[model samples]
Target: MTPAFSLAGISKRYPDFSLRDVSLTLPEGQVMGLVGVNGAG
Candidate 1:
């Protein structure tokens, strides 16, 4: 089966810091959350 959403070896550069290699998978019909320290965006 395939994942509803998937990521591999992802990275992003930000003004404060950098997001190193990250990966995740979301199955179908599942909720996901993204949070950071101090409610950072």
Candidate 2:
């Protein structure tokens, strides 16, 4: 079987925040949430 969605070595950088070396996976019939603070971006 294979993942429905995958993120390998993903990264996002900003002046105030940075996300690095991120990895994620999602199979069938699943839910995901992407959360942040009110002032987060």
Best by TM-score: 2
lDDT tens readout by residue for model 2, 1-41: 58888889999999998999999999877888776687453
lDDT, candidates in the order shown: 0.90, 0.86
Give the per-residue lDDT of model 1 (tens digit) for 1-41: 67999999999999988988999999999998887787663
- Top lDDT model: 1
The TM-score, computed over Cα atoms with residue i paired to residue i, of candidate 2 is 0.71
Clashing pairs in 2: none
TM-score of each model, paired residue for residue: 0.66, 0.71
Report the C-alpha displacement of residue 31, candidate 2, in angstroms: 0.6
